[model samples]
Target: MKLTEVQEILAKSSQEDWIVDDESGSFTYKNDLNLHIDRADFDSYREFNEPWATSHPDPHAVSVEYVVKYGSSFVDKHTLVSVDGHRATLPMPKSINDLRVTESDVNFAKIVNIGDRVDEYLKRARLVEVEDNE
Candidate 1:
């Protein structure tokens, strides 16, 4: 997927619950839930079997909330685990220079709004192009 694709998809959706945080260079969308993506870093990696429920009745059944796999110097994959144990893995860009947004990434991230409204918001925030037609 590409950034233009993301913009196009967002533009066509009906939901308007989206946010772009300039301070952190992150975007968030809310439906019944929230999905967030950080533009700056991907350092929040965790082991699948970490003891998240150390004090729970089923300590050994600790849920693996999320994981980040790396290759060489860049992130290779990002996985999200739901409370019910379902998992979804998304391939990441090889480097910052190759960073681009995809539909799956947006869907998995639960991004809601996009298009002209979002562009207008980004414009007001000065985070994207300021031209009227952009």
Candidate 2:
């Protein structure tokens, strides 16, 4: 999805984005947050599993909850998980929603209220314009 579209969705959505600070110390969006991409039908939402859940549906592969498949930015102050601000600065065609990343990264940003209103918040932070959102 386009970055602007993601921002618009986030700006318009009623649900507050969730953040998960894993034991690994990496802060990410809700576990399996974007699991709704396709294939399954509300199964992921019903499970609402956390990263630490032992009985992941796909036991063969690394648990999607724990891995940094998406929402890879906003680890902690001064330490970035993905190069660009995961959600906010991510390259388009990312598997997950940019809005989700944007919300979480800004949620735990170095400064509070920065993610509350992304346009003004990111601008005030002086973060480089995420080309994807341009």
Candidate 3:
């Protein structure tokens, strides 16, 4: 698969939908998978305090948002629901690089393996097992 296709699939597909073909060495997105990462174990995430502040594309933008906007070309939409139903302002691609998509340009599905990466981080940090939500 080409770089663009990998990106497109990732933009719309969830972690559960990643499809890897063994023979052809191609990846695709499908909804049949019954696996997923329930939550991420991270030090912190970035968020914007001043939406109007023009200091280089809102430096306070949520760390994830900053990374997606500047780091990769994921233009699709994703949402999060609040437990308290509070209103907030957040957008994709807060910067040029994010935790998931690190490199400026690469085959997303091929390069990103959230589960393994997260596990490694948690293990190295001596964090306990994060129950897989599968």
Over 16-125, each residue of candidate 2 has an lDDT whose tens digit, in order, gives: 34443323334322333641111112223222122212122332211122222224332212212211122221111122222223443343232212233434424432
For candidate 3, write residues 1-134 as lDDT tens digits: 34464445544454446555433323344542322111122234434333221233224333221122212333332322111111222222223332122222212322233332433332222323221221
Write down the lDDT of every candidate, Cα atoms only: 0.32, 0.28, 0.29
Clashing pairs in 1: 10-114, 11-114, 11-115
TM-score of each: 0.23, 0.20, 0.25
By lDDT, the candidates rank as 1, 3, 2
Measured by lDDT, the strongest candidate is: 1
Whichever of 1 and 3 has more lDDT, that candidate is 1
Model 2: weakest 10-residue lDDT segment is 35-44
Worst 10 residues of 3 by lDDT: 80-89
Q: How far does residue 32 in candidate 3 sit from its true spot (Å)?
A: 11
| Runs off by more than 4 Å, candidate 1 | 1-16, 41-134
Question: Which is the winner by lDDT between candidate 1 and candidate 2?
Answer: 1
Which sections of candidate 2 miss by over 4 Å?
Answer: 8-16, 27-32, 35-134
Off by over 4 Å in 3: 12-40, 52-61, 65-90, 93-134
